[model samples]
Target: MKPLTVIGFLGSTLDASKFGPSRWSKWRPSVALTMHEDLRVDRFVMLHGTPHARLAEYIAEDIASISPETTVDRRVLDLVDPWDFEEVYGKLLDFARAYPFDPDAEDYLIHITTGTHVAQICLFLLTEAHYLPGRLLQTQPAKRGEDGGAPGRWTSIDLDLSRYDSIATRFAAASAESTSFLKSGIDTKNAPFNRLIDEIEQVAVRSRAPVLLIGPTGAGKSQLARRIYELKKLKHQVQGPFVEVNCATLKGDGAMSALFGHKKGAFTGAAADRPGLLRTADTGMLFLDEIGELGLDEQAMILRAIEDKRFLPVGADKEVSSDFQLIAGTNRDLGRAVAEGRFRDDLYARLNLWTFALPGLAERREDIEPNLDYELDRFAEREGTRVTFNKEARERYLAFATSLDAIWAGNFRDLAASVTRMATFSPKGRIDSDCVASEIARLTRLWASDTKGDDDGLDPLLGDVALAALDPFDRVQLAHVVATCRRSRSLSEAGRALFAASRARRTSSNDADRLRKYLTRFGLEWGQVSG
Candidate 1:
């Protein structure tokens, strides 16, 4: 048996207040502590107030999601109550007795960092008793003054020299690589909606609750919902097709029957048995749009469906079962409605599991140019137009986009309409500020005429400039340009970086396709950008 590595987690009233759950954004304090596979490890966490056993399961789930390859025995040990050190000693005795360490396996890497007083005492006990095979402290606040002033200085301490160093180094490298990989992926896509994507992920993973995405019409609420569904699917947390219903259009008896299904002859109008939206959405996501408009009675029925995971079909004698994750979207403030007795509080409570407030187009001023540019590309591709942005026009578009205040209050629909107008009115295949600004004025009039309000429109477009140095790909592509112009390495030097390493001996046409993809990411093309 290898040394039974014991990891100590701090679970105390004080520590609980400082870390865990709410500190979700904090990158793990010491990736160094958790990185090695060579050492056998176990984890113990302490929490103040909350049930430790219950919290342990949440932590275990999170850790498994993030690092699927690792295995560890996890527990929450409480010893701070009654202010007795013996409570701490008693718990450790049981743990140490069960899985005695075997140093021969190069085993027993104890990594514990939790927020609890009992955990701290346990750390001290293991060190004093010489039973701590390996240990890791996840976080340490700077020592504060008597009056809570600065304790001063930051430091790192490690034990177990070679073993600890080896483990930490390997872990750091892998962590850095993963960080770099995600960064590269995000950068490559220029994902302007990254914030929305991130919010959905955190909300889904952290809480087993319904997420209500509220935004103005055409603000891409449905699109965002589908994107979230896809991401959840990728994570294997969701398996059912995304079932969507626009509640504003669902009317009277039809709405109930559509959502709850009906048995033949149960209702006067019913001719045959029908399965409702509730069942159709079994084991998947049910996206309800315009939920604020659902009638009071229908709201009660839907609420029951969500809370009980079962619902009665229209005209059906018995209830049917279906499990579905609910994601509701609305433009109205349901909270205010609840207070005014306009919305059902009971149903609201169930849907309030998690709520995400989406920023309107006007609020996300920074996103205007990118979204426009993306739309422009889509239009250009659809038209098969050889469109490249001109400097003055692009800059002017960007300026207008960033300058808007109440951008139509219509959200994404307004933006799409603006894009269509700009594309339709462009004189030169490329668009300029005139295109963006003119549409804004036009949209202002159209929206204002419709609502008697000067609701706003999209900002100007941002122009793209070819890098003076060309991208890495371009530089390499025109290597001959480099060879002839810069008088640098000949075609040979360029070929090596541009070619596959496997074909060191044969250079011509060697893995050029693979090289181009990597080069494109570098922002380079053959002769134009390079040399």
Candidate 2:
């Protein structure tokens, strides 16, 4: 079995012991820890200040005398003042970065018992942060009541918080709060989508690997990527600005020069040395939106850049390096693009490591109401105007927005535009039935124009065969009937809407009976039409 390596500060005062048969005078915590039979120490890395260098040597000699088989490596880490946490932590962190760690060859432990309080804290931080891939070992003086008392005891503690219920609960709650913050406080109803966001929130804070967002346009891929960057920045996980590029807008050599820069006089437009978006994203995040639109040559270069962190700029002789986290957003099916020889299959495989799919607004209609409020809030902040829908108007608009008629082809973007139009047109800070009606009409016209084939809306209700059998005049009339029936809650409501002019002419109104009879002519009932 591979032996365990122990690392810590040399306890100058406590480690220099007087020779004695009594355990209290003879045993030092660091020496006792090394002497533990089952907990074998193969390598000991002792950190010491200049003042304690001689004492550290004495401690090392004693440790060797007690545990003859272990190898000792001492490091001189001079802190101006060991009590100053900032200075102490910085020096220890630097040492940890420089130290060679081989986790596969040996298990490791941070010996926290021998250091000053500040040094102990710094060591714990390095270990917990994964700069030191090791558990912690603290040695304690032996129990005094035992006959002639024995040597000190050693204990190993793990930093995995899941092993402790109370800590795990706290961490889980904090993680949930962070996830909600990343989502802009919007509570999504779709369980899978919510879970996906939660996972993404964790990954954004924990890992710096490339993330690929796959979804249709306006599905919030770009927004989520920016949010991830913001979250990482908020946590101090990244120190640079978020740089975004839409690959779809980039074309040819201009795209290359824009992303990777060029040497002075390298091209006609290159008047001076230019640093590009990749370098701008150093120590931060790079969001490549519509990444599938990138040409094959750029894809190959990007693959090299992501894998090697080094790439030669356009017409540049030497390669520049930028260590940036990548977040790629795409509406296209890259797998299909790969099969068709459009995208590089190798690059696709690399970016596919961490992939997420964002659902479009049409798929999460239940979230529309909350997102409506969110968009209105954004508009108010941006335009310096506040607009709200009346209770009835809000209900009406939400019903229509959630309906099948509202195709929402542009997803969140479409919803945001709809809200913007209504909010802009609303007078006196309130949107009523009139405003809702106008916006609905405008949206309907927009959606209608965007759609292809039949403008005859009866195809959904009556199907093709039934519609073909009907006269052109009858088809038009039936479309109106079906639409009215859909909007009404009952037969009488449909009758009132469809026969408003005729009902006014009648002395005695049997509107419900008339509507029922009319619907029977088409072999349709209230349930069939309304549902």
Candidate 3:
């Protein structure tokens, strides 16, 4: 709700000729100016009407992500029109006086966008007379061409802001930090999350820190870690597969065996010698999911493995060392758990050295739309449905989502489930309020009935929603196998149930390939989400 950050992208849209008719249309000139990447305007105050709303909407929608802080405002100060001279002059003076810039000079960024020559002249005059705080308007080209029978044909020029006025004094920091990992690094150095990403991005490139991504499950902590991995991949020392380890499955002695390779007869279950996860992840990133669940004994062993880069197998006498980057994940708070004698204090400290905490969906409500848009695109591509939610639907959905309590224990997972359900059931092309409401109501009734039903009848299963699409040409079917996996939430168990039912449907190597592809897109392994 802060004031818009003004950035001047000022230029001219009129390219009328001296003698005959206008050499080219001003309509197209204005049109092109609207699409300029750096032109940060929120409310496009139209100078003229013919090149109307559709132009404003496109520019606002397109650059909305880039200029997160600017408000693109437009106003047509008609000088030659029938209105009296003083009336026009008074309005201009008032507008220049009331322009929503911070009282202190340093807070605003003036980006003057291209329009009429008169408009640029007016802005220059106003700024020069101290009516506006910043510099003069910058006039940019309306058209690009090789020659109009001259050495070079140029339509516009970069007029300095000093043409109108100039000022000096700068002590304060920015409204937000300019440092970012993405194209607009504004958010990367703002507040809480800023320090985390900045340090991570910097140290990740320079030093080697066994990154431990700790956050509530489904907070996109892993995704952030992956981003860091990608960023590091840009550096010289990093390369190879980002191997993953689920310590939840590596229980007791089994955990030891999985982490450190075992010789044949290392244990009763060790029918064959095998390399541990650490080795399999050699010279790469080894992601350990649910690190909090690791037992005390296992924690001590992992500390050893980390310190020495070596570990003794469950039954093997010799030691094997691994050279791999370790990245740990967990939903539980190891700090609190450590104080209470659950997670090991030492392990927690080592992992905490460089950490990133992803704010949950309900925590950072501003990000809901962006995340939803991303998820919608992802699900649409996967489902093969050209589904799009209209503004009304998105607004309502976001409002409802942002209003939720912190108990959205599942976070993005829950939102995704809701979206996938809506897309699957909502009539062919669009999603609306009816769709959102109906899904919620149907689930409510189902839950009510399930809880209240008598033992006399079979307990009804929950509303298990799954989205699947098919590519008939390849004879490949993308099925979430919703029916068989009705009772499961885990991806692996669901996949197991799916495979059990899949055999009854059809047996094909192609189906397995399709399934693998689906798993990759979902970021799930056969063991994670199946049954």
Candidate 4:
């Protein structure tokens, strides 16, 4: 085994005594630490100020007399205020850095029984951070009725808490709780999404840097941002309120004024001094939802504010300051926007440090079941009435929801709305198969309408005359096929979905090939249709 080395401060009051044999009567932590028979401390590094030099020498000599094998190295660490955490910690850190720590050949222990409370705390922190690279040794005076003349009791605490199963379990449980909190208590099963939440939870707790959330509308970016803020607040990381801003709603001068505050009479509608969203979020969190919608000018100002925590209010000469943690949410492709000159590249780079892409509801089909229950619970809380689906209805809804045909265009918003409608229409608060069927039909029609209304299914690619030339039957069938292809990730996936019922009936089913030929019939390629 390696030689044991103990490092500690000499307690000026406790370690000090008369130079004769009377000093050995009382229990002094520093002196008692060396006299323990089981410890076998090979070296003792005693730290003290100039005033305690004589006392330190006396203790070291006395310790040497008790333990002839134990070598004492007295170090003078002069401190103006021993209780000042910064000065004491800095001095100890410097000593730790300068010291030759040979853990391979020397076992180290930091004696915490000596020094001020601040010094002890600094020692613990240093040891925990592995700067000291040792276990903590805490010595206590022996209680009454015990051998008062003998050395006091001592305990060694290993800084590696993972070695203790109970402590490790508690830490793991706390981490899991944090991740669950980030997910808003939803037992999300999607591996990628769960991993993303875990990463976000870590970043939310450990960092104050800007976090950029990229996802489609209603993919829970806003909700996740709020949850992050709440978690931070719970951890006492922030004291101020969460201030959320929909950047899409702010336009031109209004965007500038709203984000950076405004002086009274700064603009046409500015009748009073506005504190702005940034100011409102001071010492807390600022969630800029739809941040990509902000214009170049506003983006530039935001970048400055994020970097400096200072920005000029509208019509104000001097800049105001607001220190806030930023969580930006956007559906737009910021990388493309930067390349197209719509977004500032510098700002993109800054926010890109911790970018998380949240998968849409359709992408996280496995998580739909859990979120379904979550939405129902949320509905109950909102409506003050509990509603549940019949077992068959629940299974049927889950099947349909997880199927590719169910295009969750609006993501969770659509899911929540569908549930709310079903619950509101369900007789006696129990949704039956009929209710599920109606909701499925309603959602299908709604998604179909959105897809068709936005882009007249093959109208953009094929002009009016080409679409008009087709038969009504062919037009309807082709339109639906094209829509499915556009929504699908690949030709094979689209083919599997389009021919879900019939693919198994065929002996050698080539779904992608079948889809390719079908598209070719209308002189349409997969690339053209899918794009």
TM-scores, all candidates, are 0.47, 0.54, 0.48, 0.60
**lDDT leader:** 4
Model 4 earns a TM-score of 0.60
Query: Which rank order by lDDT, best down to worst?
Result: 4, 2, 1, 3
* Global lDDT of each candidate: 0.56, 0.79, 0.54, 0.85
Worst 10 residues of 3 by lDDT: 456-465
Error of 4 at 481 (Å): 4.6
lDDT: the better of candidates 2 and 4: 4
For candidate 2, what is the total of clashing residue pairs?
0
Error of 4 at 212 (Å): 0.9
Query: Model 1: what TM-score?
Result: 0.47
The TM-score-based order of candidates, best leading, equals 4, 2, 3, 1
Writing each residue's lDDT as its tens digit, candidate 3 over 1-531 gives 323234332222232223223432333333333344544334433343333444445444433544444455655444454234344435555565446544232333233444444444544444443344443323344336522211111122323322211322111222235555521223322255555666667767776767777677777766666666666676646676777766778776777777777899976878998987877876777788889888888888788777778887777778888776777888887888998998998888888887766666545555566556556655644543324565577666766665422224466776677778887665343577788677656545543464353231111211123222323332122232432232343445444545655666765535445555665663445444332
* Number of the predicted model whose TM-score against the real structure is largest: 4
Give the per-residue lDDT digits (tens) of candidate 4, residues 297-342.
Answer: 8889899999999999998988999999999999999999999999
User: How many clashing pairs in candidate 1?
Assistant: 32
Candidate 3 TM-score over all chains jointly: 0.48
